[model samples]
Target chain A: MIIDGLINGIALGCIYALVALGFVLIYKATHVINFAQGEIMMFCSYICYAGSTTFHFNFILSFFFAVIAGFLLGALLERLFIRPLIGYPILPVVIATIGIAMVLQSVAALIWTFEPQKLDPFSGSPYQLWKVSISPVHLWTIIITFILIFLFSLFFRHSLVGIKLRAIAEDLIGSMASGIPVRRMYNFTWGLAGAIGAVAGILVAPVIFIHPHMGSIGLRALPAAVLGSFGSIPGAVVGGIVLGVSETIAGLYLPKEIKDVFPWLLLFLVLLIRPEGIFYTYEQKKV
Target chain B: MKKIKVLAIVGLCVACFLSFTSNTIADTGVNKKVILVGGSLDLTGPAAFMGQGVKRGINLYFNKVNAEGGIHGRKLKYIAEDDGYVVAKTVSNYKKLTLKSRVFCLLGSTGSVGPKALKPYLEEDKIPLVGPYGYTSAMFRPFHTYLFNIYATCEDQAKIFVDYLKTELKLENPVIGLLAEDNEIGQDTIRGAEAQVKKVGWQAPVVELYKRSAIDFSSQVLRLKAKNVDALFFPVISSHSAQILKECQKANFQPLLFATATATDLRFLKMAGDSAYFGKGLRSFATQINHRDNSSGAEEFRAAIAKYDPSNKDPNSFNLFGYGIAKILCEGLQQAGADLTREKLISALEKMDGYETGIFAPMTYGPNNRQGTDSVRILRADHNKKDFVIETGWLHPE
Candidate 1:
């Protein structure tokens, strides 16, 4: 049972990692939180479902269409909503994202209806490793999350645009003065975050199924973001895995009602003990 | 200017007097033209789909009734408020609907927690709550005068599931297990299962309750497998049921699964996907008859929704429940003879004995008994047909 829990925990942690990457990407680039990350993920998943079911696209084609849709949606949302609030109070921009989340959810429900729709997993068969059984979806989620993380590390460290995004995140005015298109950077940040979240949603949908409100699961990833110090890309992945394993092991020992509380409890402890998070170095911000 | 101001003030006072005195004119949402009823539903919550389906079902019946000149010249108007499945929100909606809107009664308040929270206010106000969609045992045991339930308690369904396995399936000393939600509904099922375990001399079932949001059921399934449980009693919604069943199949653990009505929805099949094979032949205690049952109620519901609620061409279990509740409520109102009061409606509802709601079996309620039905039919999930098949006629708990 513990082994099974460990496997499942890792699988769930990978999903939370992908979602945390959504938060990390937007915050790391723009220094503004996108509260609508979950809704964007949900919308893109529905697009994938529609692509497969309505448009008769194959799974790969469906995924491609979803990622493109997610990118466009993020770009459009940033252009329409976030750009206006640039250089304003961070709190209001955050508040505006919450509004965007609500609007996006309502729009998704209107388009797709608020029912749990099914998406076929890419490939899955119960496989055994060392006499312990693991689900195909869980295994695939881990594989995809790691691949994305590897690609992300290379993109951030080696790619020119990646350094530009880092520069924008560190000093927005400095980047703008240094000839980096600040508005374009913001749009790219939001778009990339949306695309990353779409991957997570599409992968997780096969396991939990798809619904407009399924995006609420994205909220669980918030603790992962916090644990990863909210800004560190690698921190999101590591923090997510730790939180997932903590919950699973907690379930093994604690009563079921108390088990779900483990994630929030961990979040509190992290904040109380090391608010900088496991993978982050705290730096003072100047006004 | 002063004279005009005095006239404006007099006009404002007159308007206030007319609005405040309007209750007497309508007699608390009842009038010669319309009767305003209310529903505190989870129309925009986690269970929003269920709430919307039920609301559509009820609206189908109401729109049909209204088109046919209504119940004795008074049109039934159902105003639903979205409570988001929160207890406090349900209470707030109920209070606003009753105190401000002066709605006559509440139909199909969404979840057990919401209804359980409203018990005190219900007792205090004495507003007859007809067809509340919940399965709390407290509603039945220490029965509230105003809260009239539409279905058997979760405990009743649990007992029926166990009894069916014992007698009909003939499982001699079966090892039963419970995978339930951490809520009153889950507790009720556990209560019934525990009682049966003691009665039949079966070993105590390895029980585990999960948070409503917790989708991972691998550990629970593995735990059940380790215990060698022959049967698992489930009291959860369809989405969670699909996830759990798939997890069980992935682990190669198959047990005789018996779920409540909520888990037996056709929606589960769609959600279970290729993993739907695991749900094959799974059983559940059904509240309303299957849409494919070819019964009069099924036919009527189909025809009604087709004409009145065309959007809901394929109504699920929630829709049927709403249709049944509306049917019963309408009958009681008709029996009340157009002169409806809280007391009168309560008396009329209490007098129901073997009253057919077209969807459910004859539901009888007495002064001491407020439950709509104590019987449920057994349904088997048929993945091949992608629908639920009725396995047995209506059977009560032994």
Candidate 2:
């Protein structure tokens, strides 16, 4: 039972990791939390739907294009809306991201008409091993989330561009002096974040119904980001899974009324105990 | 210094002009007469789509009445606010709409949390809150004369579902399973389902609860598939209902599913795709047809809504509910005659019985029975269709 719960928890955690990875990418490079990351994921998922249904592409091709679209849109948004606010306070950037989320949500609602779209691309039934039964849809989500995480880690570790991004994250002025295009790095980080979020959205959409508000699930992952360490990629995955499993267990074992509140309670307790995060380093900024 | 004096003079002139305009408008205004009806619609939040449909319904009836003539010569103004289905926000907004806006009466208020918050206020104000879409036993209880129910209570609706299973479907000793939101309303529904099982003298079925904003219910459905529940009873919010149905389909657990009015919507039909119209459930009220077997009222509703809310045509229980409340309020105002005080409206509402405004099932209210519509009918949604086909006529309150 513990293994079953852990497996499920880790799989769910992978999703949070993907979101957290996006956060890490943007935060490391730009020192900004893209509040609209979830909405960008949602927008990309809608694109994936359009690609699959309207354009009649297979799931993989549709998903690929969706990610690409997310990347382009993310980069474009940064150029148009975000770049103009350079050297300004971070609060305006956060608020601007929020407005962008609103616009994207409204546009999606206007186009889709507030009805949740059903996507059942996969064939066949659940795979059962003893008491543990796993649906193909969830299995798909679990697999995709892991692969994306692996690829993201690889990109950040091995690639030259990734090193440039890391340098910029470490010190923007120093990286600029070292001939790194800091602005391009910022745009690239956002684009990469958008692409990763899009992937997360698509992975989850098959199991869940596609609705405009579905992307807002990203907000729930914020605790995961904080718990995992704002800069640690793997930490987010652990935190999200921990949160999901705890919430699931609480919903069943604990009082049902406070199930939604349980995850936050757990996060608060974790924060109090370990202000540096459970798995990641506690970086103290000297003001 | 010269600039400051000049600015001060301009500001004074502007203030005077504004005051003069206000005085003129106040004197000419025919008492700013509009009967304020407060609604806790989920306008721009998670269940915003449901709110939009409800707004469509309210706008429909109000427009119809206003177009022909005002309700007792007083224009019906619905002071609708977005609660977003949060309890604390609902309480705050109810205060703003009640104490600040001072709406005449709370008509057709929806959402599980909204009514729970405003109930005490409604009671204290002695305001006749009629046709609240939610049907918690608490709404029926402690007998607040001001509180009137439109939909049958969850327990009552669950009992009717069991009745349909026994009588229409002819299923005996049926193994039932219930999936509900982990909230007061959902728990109330579970309680109602459990009671029905016991009352029918059958073995209790499995009861499952999900988080309110759960995106997927496949795991829960998989467990139910193992149980092989013959009939499934669950009251789901708009978004989650569609998710549950899709998951059930994926799992191939096609049990006879019965959802309350909350799940009854065109969005459900679209979301369910091929499997939309395959169940019978309790509606708050269906305004598509009347006891006289005419669609004239429904037709009028469509036309009125088209004129006002022409963009939105996706009708559901909420739309009909909106029409029903508008009709009820209009009738109450008419019965109140020329005098349209809050007390007069309450008195008129209390006196309402056998009053048919050609919209919804006949609504009756008296001193003893505060739960309006003493009965709720079972309506079956036709697959891929807009409205439900009436299965049974007005099942009396159990």
lDDT by residue (A208-263, candidate 1, tens digit) is 88888888877989999999999999999998898788887787767766688998
Q: Candidate 2: where is the Cα deviation over 4 Å?
A: A1-14, A46-66, A76-136, A169-174, A210-212, A223-230, A234-287, B1-40, B72-103, B223-228, B274-300, B303-316, B354-359, B379-390
**Please, what are the lDDT tens digits per residue for candidate 1 over residues B1-398?**
99999999999999999777653526467877778889999888778888998888889889989999998888898999999888889989988999888898888867777877888888888887888887777776787888888788888888888889888999888888899888888889889888977788877778988987785777677778888888887878778888877887777777887777776666776676555456334787888787766899989888887888777656788888888899889988888887777788888888999998768868899988887787888888776787778899888888
For candidate 2, lDDT tens digit of each residue in B120-169?
87778776777776767777677777777665666676677777777778
Give each candidate's interface RMSD in Å.
Answer: 1.9, 4.1
Clashing pairs in 2: B277-B383
> For chain B alone, what TM-score does every candidate structure achieve against the true structure?
0.91, 0.81
Cα TM-score of candidate 2: 0.79
For model 1 the local lDDT of residue A280 reads 80
Query: DockQ for each of the predicted structures, in order?
Result: 0.44, 0.22
Candidate 1: TM-score? 0.90
